[model samples]
Target: MGWALAGRARSTDEQVLELLEPYAGNRHRICRLIRLAGARAARFGPRLAPQEHRFH
Candidate 1:
């Protein structure tokens, strides 16, 4: 799920937020996925842009 959430190239912010809505209930499963999803988002997110600064 998190992979899908992060990997859908054509997906919009609205779509991603909508997909995440069900997981916001704070159940253990949902919470764990939320964290994992966040990490995935960061990995695949705009921080990878060429003009962006990179930290060691």
Candidate 2:
């Protein structure tokens, strides 16, 4: 699931919604997962500088 989300990191929300439309019953839950994954990625994806690690 992580790898799949990572691969679609650049995809727009609309695109994701379209892709997930088939799973109508779980679409909301899936969207929530995507949001959580995005938040996690933003929190730990990369550092702007080598020294930035000390802040975390």
- 45, model 2: CA deviation in Å? 7.5
RMSD of 2: 6.9
State every prediction's TM-score relative to the real structure: 0.33, 0.40
- Model 1's alpha-carbon lDDT is 0.59
Give candidate 2's TM-score: 0.40
lDDT of each: 0.59, 0.62
Q: List, residue by residue over 1-56, the lDDT tens digit for candidate 1.
A: 43455666466667756777877775467647657766443244355446656776
Compared with the true structure, what per-residue lDDT tens digits does model 2 show for residues 1-56? 33354554467767766677777899778768867766543344555655554655
